[model samples]
Target: MTDLNTLLQSPIRWMSQATDPDMRHFLRDLQANILKGHGRHFTGNIFVSFEGMGAQAVARLLRDLSGYVTSALQQLCTARSSAGPGFDGGPVRCLLLGAGAYRALGNLATMPGDAAFQAGMRARQVALADPPAEEWGEGAWRPGNPAPDAMILLANSSFEAVTRDLEAAEGWLNGSGARVLGVERGRAQFRTFRPGGPAEGVEHFGYVDGRSQPLFLAEDLKREAAAYAEEPAPAGADTGFDPAFPPSQFILADPNARTELGAGSYFVFRKLEQRVRAFKRREEALAEALGLTGTKAARAGAMAVGRFEDGTPVVLSDNATEAAPPNNFSYANDPEGMRCPFQAHIRKTNPRGESTPKLPPEAPAERSHIMARRGIPFGDGVRDFEADAGQEPEGEVGLLFMAYMASIEGQFEFTQQVWANNPRFLRGLAPGEVPTGIDPVIGQGGDEAARTQLWPAGEGKPMVPFSFADFVRMQGGEYFFAPSRSFLREVGL
Candidate 1:
C-alpha cells in the first residue's frame, strides 16, 4: 500500500512520463477544481433538489452524470497548450453532492465525517455571523426551501458557451428525476493597467484577486520559484514566503469509494455582495478624517484592504506601483501592526506569520487553517480603480467566493469565525494593546466598536480612530463535497 502522506509530500509532476502509478491514479480519480482552480472565464452553478425523486431514480441520474465529470488529470491535459495559467476546456463540468444528497441517496452514514457539513450552512448561521436565511437572496439555503442536494458547475471560455451548456444541462436534469432550483452565473474580469501587459484578475471592487495561493503541484512550485528568481528583488523585499502546501491540506479519503486511492475535498460556496459605492465613499471619508489628501489619500483604501487596487501590499510599500505586486513577504518584520494594520482585510484573514501566541510562519497549527480559494467576481460593475464619484456599483455585484479544504470546521469556519469576524485577534502579540478590530471588508455581525480600526499615524504619534461600515453582505451559501471521480462513478451502483 502506498503511504499517501509520503507520496503527497513530494509534488506530483502530471506531465512526467516516469510518474509513479499511485500518484497518477490519485490525480486521475480526483475531480478538477481542487488541486488547481478551473480558471475558465465563464462559470454557471446549477442548484438541484431531489426532494420528491425516488432514491433509485436519483442514483441513476447521478451515475449517468458521472461520466461527464472532469478530473484533475483531464483538466491539466486540456490546458497544457494554453499560453496562460488557466484551463482551456470549454464547458467543463464538476458535480458536488451536498450532505442532503447523501441522505436522499440513503447513504448518509457513509458520508465523510464532517459535523459542519452534516449540520448544513444555515444551521451554523450564528457561528458564521451570517444573516438569517429569510434575509438571504432568493434560492438561498433555508429550512422548508427545498434544500439543494446537488450542484452542477459548468465553466467555459465564453458566456455564450457557458449559457448553451447550462441550457443543455438543465434540459436533461429536468427529466432526470431532479428539479433545478436556481442558477448562479459568474464571469472572470481582468484589468490591463499597462498598454500591452497581460490583464490581471480583479474583483468588482477594483482590486486584484487570487494573487496569493498555496501551491500543491511540484511543477507549479518550480514555475513560481523560477518567476520569483528571475524578477529582481526590490529594496528590503522579504522573499521568505513559502507557497508550497502538502496534499493533506485539501485531500481527504472517500469513505464510500471502491478503491484506496480515491479521495475528495470539502467545498464551500458563498455569494458575497459588495457595496462598492458605500465602501469607496467610506474610504474617502476615512482619508479626510486622517487629514490625508491628494495622492496620499489612496492609503485609506489600501489600509482597509491590506493592498492597493494595483495588487501591491500596503505593508511593503506605502504607494501602489506599476510593477507586478509581490506576495513573498510575512508580518514578522512589522510586529506592531504599523505597516499593515491588524484589521486590514488580508491581514485579518491571513496573518502570514502573526498569531495570537506569535506562531512562526511554517507552524503546522497556523498553516493548517489555509484553504485553496478559487473565487471569481459575479456581477457587472466597476472594474477600474479611478472610477468617477457616481460610477461605483451599489448592488448585485460581488465575489462568488468558492474554496476547497480538507475540513470545513478547521479551515473555512476557523478563518471566518476565529479570525475575520473576531475583534480581539492578534491581541497577545503585544501587551496593553486595544482590540485589533474585525476585518473591514468581510467582517460581519460586529458592534460599532468591534468594527473600529486603529490607523497608525507617524512614529510616536497616537493612532487615528476610524470605524468601518459593513460593505460586504453574505447572500447565500452551502457546504458540499466534491467526490472523487471513482466514487462518483460507483456511488449509484
Candidate 2:
C-alpha cells in the first residue's frame, strides 16, 4: 500500500522517485479531477442514462467508456510536462457514475456506502430547500425522469477543443445503448481591471471567486505559502491560515474496484441560475438604504458578499481598490461579525475557523467541512454594471457548480443546510443578536423577513437591515461518484 501521508506531503517528489510500485498503481487507478482541479477554460458535461439495460449491457458500456477516462497519474504527468496528449497538451476527461448506474451494472451492493448517494439528489429536495421537480428545467433532477446513470465530464483549454471532444463522445454513445440525457457547457469568464490589462476570474455577480480553497497536496501548500510571502502583507493580517489538508479529506477506497489501492470521490453537480440584474439592483438599493455614499457605497455589496468585487475581503480591508487581495486572513479578529458579517456568502460557506467558540484556534471542525470546488460559469456577455434596470440576464446564465468531497452529507450538504440556508447559524457565537440570516448569494428558501446585518456606521453602531432575495436559483443537480479508473476498466468482467 502507498504511504498516503508521505505521498500527499510531496506528490512531485513521490512521483519523481517512481520506485514504489504500490504508489504508482494507486495513482494510476484513481481518476483525475478529484485530487486537483482540471483548470481548463472550457468544459462539457454529458449526462447519460440507461433505460431497461441489463447488467451485462451496462458492463459492456463501462468497458468501452473506460478508454476515455483519464487517471490521476496521467493528469499529474501532463501537468509536469506540456508535451503530453490532448488539446493544449492536456484535456481532462472524467467519468462519474450515479447510484442507478451502479445498480444497472449489478454493483450497487459494493459501491461507496453513502446514503445520500444511494437515495440520489432528488430525495434531498426538501432538506436542501431546492425547487420542486417541475421548477427544474429539462434534463435536470425531476420525478419520474430517469436519473442520470453516468456523467462524462470533458474539459480542455479552448471552446473548440471541448466541442470537438463532446461531439465525439456523443456520437459514440449514440450506438452504445446509453442515452444522452442532458448536456451542459461551461466556459471561464473574467473581468478586466483596466482597458488593456489582463482579466481576472469573476462569476456572474462580478465577485472574484475560487479563492480560499483547501490545499490537499504538500507542493500546493508550499506554493501558496511562497506566493503569500511574495505579496505585500497588510498590517493585522493573520498569517496562520493553513490551507493544507490530508488526502483522506477527499479520497476514499473504492469498494468494488479490481485493485485494493482504488480510490474515488463523491461528486456534487448543480446548475445555478443567477439573476444578475436583480442582484446588482439590490446591491445599489441596499447601499442607499444604509445611507452609504461616495466610495463607501461599495460596502453594501461587500457586506452581503464578504468581499468586494475586486476579491478584497471586507474583514481585511474596507477599500475594494486595494491591490492583490490577500486570502490569508481569518475571522479570529472579527469574531463578533463586526467586520465580515456572519451571513456573508463567503463567511456562510467557509467559516474560516470561527464557527465554534470552544474549538481551538485551528478550528478543525470548520476546516473539515471544506470541499474541493471546481465550478465554472456557463453563460455569455460581460455583465453591464452600468446597464438599465431591465438589462442583464435574469436566467439562462449562471454557474455549473461542481465539487468533490469524501462525504456528501458531511461536507457539501452540511455546508448548505446547516450554514448557508440556516438563518440561525452563528447565532450561538453572538448571543442576543439578530439572526445571522441566510447567505444572500446562494441561500434558497427563506421568508421575506430574512435580512442580513450591515454596520455602515462601523462598529458599535446599530446594523442596517437588508432583506435577502433569491438572486441565485437552482436549475437542476445530481450526486455521483467519480469511480476509480481500475473499476471502470475491469467492471465488465
- Highest lDDT model number: 1
- List candidate 2 stretches off by more than 4 Å: 3-14, 83-87, 107-109, 140-144, 194-198, 232-234, 237-239, 358-364, 381-390, 428-431, 451-456
* Residue-level lDDT tens digits of model 1 in 1-493: 5766666666667776236777678778888888888878888999999888877777788889999999888887777667565535665799998998888878523767899998889889999999988888875344457668889999889888988999999999988878888888898888886666678899877888887798888889999998778655545545356788888888888777667788888999999999989998899999888777999898889989999888888888888877777777777667788877888988888887567356655555877898899888897543555655567889888899999999999999999998899998866335777998889999988898888878886578789989985999998889999987887777767
Instruction: Write down the TM-score of every candidate.
Output: 0.94, 0.92
- Model 2 Cα lDDT, one tens digit per residue, 102-160: 88877533667999999898889999999986788766355556778888999999888
Error of 1 at 215 (Å): 0.6
For candidate 1, the C-alpha RMSD (Å) to the true structure equals 2.5
What local lDDT score does residue 14 receive in model 1, on the 0 to 100 scale? Answer: 71
Query: All predictions: root-mean-square deviation over Cα?
Result: 2.5, 3.0
Please give the RMSD of candidate 2 to the true structure: 3.0
The TM-score, computed over Cα atoms with residue i paired to residue i, of candidate 1 is: 0.94
Q: Rate the local accuracy (lDDT) of all candidates.
A: 0.82, 0.80
